[model samples]
Target chain A: MESHIELSFEDIRGKQHATLIHFIGDLDATNIELVLEKVFNLINEGTVNIIADFKQLRYVNSTGLGILLHFSKTAREKGGCFKIANINENVYEIIEIIGATTLLEIYDDVDEATAALT
Target chain B: MTTQRMEIDIQEVPESEGVVILHFSGDLTSECVRRINECFSAVGKKGKTYAIANMAEVTLISSAVLGEFMGCRKRLIEEHGDLVFCGLDLEMRTKLHLMGATKIFRIYTDIRTALNSYKWEIERQPEKFHVSFPPYLKIVPPLRQLVSRIARQKGYGNRDSFRIETIVDEICNNAVEHGRPKADDLIDLTVIIDPDKIEIDVRNMSDPDKVASLTAMLLPEKTDTDKPKPDVKRGRGLSLIKMLSDGMSVECTDRGTSVRVKKVREE
Candidate 1:
């Protein structure tokens, strides 16, 4: 099934941009490629600071993580930062155990991650 | 396949009406928190002081689900109910204990004993078997559903089934997305189900060096005064698998990398 993934962008402060990508429904192989494409597009446009708001994200598999890693690398190379905010603790732990916390910043709230970008 | 409605029933105990019994079933994930909250809210309406979750029929609960449990407990206490738990299988209990919730929730072997201190009747053990799958990127949800059904037939509940499904999805997807050189490259998955526990073993013929690098990449050495740079997406999958399963073992031999996940059945 196709996932209803939503990506919202907001300019937090200065060059610090917060793109809130809400992953709704299943983020499986069916639509992960599209999601990755969207993420790359945002990074290519220099949308540096990103906060993936996973409040609405129901599920995410390994392919989803691969996409996130790809974008995180791109963001870092461009001197930008990528973070995830407002994630459910379960989702946060999933991200944490995968050592995503080591590679990407995780915030309890969007404000905190946005503040870091500033 | 029928999409089941989430349901929770809370009843006041006769001896200690302060203790509420929460019976829940179906998939308990982040999305189901609102429903769980509603159940807690209903229990709060009764004005009881303490509560216990009757997890007998509950098959699986994710870390997110556990968070919701804690969150609900906090909410209940704020309204005068102390939260506890009953009917957790060894797998669920172990996960909760590992997360330090065993200290948080008062766990019992069964609902009747938890409710009235009556002799708890433990059910007979279920048959167990192991099955393996080849790693590939496109995960077959139906196959996962079938496995879950098999588990349920063996007396595992929906919650446990969901846990198995989630782990399988994570491991198989990793093999497909990162482990294999091509889409057709096989990722082997094996599930061993016995009365006591279910053990999942997944193997893929990927580059061992790449696997080692992936492992190293997961635990980056900390430098002075600064946090390590986030890799963005590549790292969370394995970590999530580790967090969800009771125990995990990762081994990379000359041929491939193997990940084994075990979930014990509750009595």
Candidate 2:
């Protein structure tokens, strides 16, 4: 399956900029490189306040989850806030199992997740 | 004395005074597994239960294909008919014997012996079932589990059932990890089941050149000291596949590579 990892920048009320990134398909060792590269590029471009939408992701293996964790840490260290939103049940359980929910702000709705980043 | 190198011809064998023989040729790797399954399905639908797979043309047969042959034999048995092998080269015979399939299947030197043996049985069991699968990898975990469920339903007990599950997972994982393209690649899987055995054929669209490297990495050479280095962590996946499967065969061609695995039901 093809993954469309899109990063869009939005100016929220002229006070903050939010980068919304959507992940799709199975996130395993196979395609984790693509995700990491995209996230790193966005971070290097100073797009720190971000929301990762996991709505279309069906499964996340340990390697995939690890990449997400590393990206969150890198974003945080760079003074940018990272939030996750629209996580489906399967991916949500994986994220929860890995205790990522406790480490990062997770929201059910995109608006709330983006709002948290702002 | 001349070596009398083996020669094989794939021809239709007529059995029971009317049935035709479906012959198989070349190596039975992952690529040819689907074709073999399709041939089985086509012959099965014709109400011809007894048939001979003339393997004289097959020079190199993989373990996966051998397993698939066992599965086919089990399938024919349930219909009161049987599948027999004829024209196996010496190397093929030795390999089959090593895998302990010599007792499980009736091997014949020629097609006539196999046909004569199945003539009466074919009369009583004319109905045959055939199944086929495409060459792609699908990530439907439920469907993957469903294959094992069908095997269990056929009375293949718990241990063999779990074995099937693990073998399928490892083979499919290899295709997903190494066979298909990075973003849009898919591994094609085809599974068939009868009363006695289950045959699974997996095809991955991978570069054939890499297969040798991958296989070598998975089956590394042992050092003279008889000790494995602690840091070398390769070949685990292939070792696991070999351990779990009753028969495993791999073939890499210009088009793609195919792996065939077969698990037989215990009586």
Pick the lDDT winner.
1
Tell me the tens digit of each residue's lDDT in model 2 across B148-248.
67667656676666556656655776776666465554466777655566777777777666677555544436222332222232223455455455676
Per-prediction tally of clashes: 33, 14
lDDT of 2 at B100: 89
Tell me each candidate's RMSD, in Å, in order: 17.0, 18.9
Once superposed on the true structure, which residue ranges of model 1 sit more than 4 Å away at CA? A1-18, A28-30, B1-123, B127-136, B141-163, B174-196, B201-260, B265-267
The ten-residue window of minimal lDDT in model 1 chain B covers B117-126
- What lDDT score is found at residue A64 in candidate 1? 70
User: C-alpha displacement of A115 in model 1, angstroms?
Assistant: 3.8
Question: What CAPRI-style quality would you assign to candidate 2?
Answer: incorrect
lDDT of 1 by residue, A18-84 (tens): 5666556556665777777887787777677677777777656655766766677777787777777
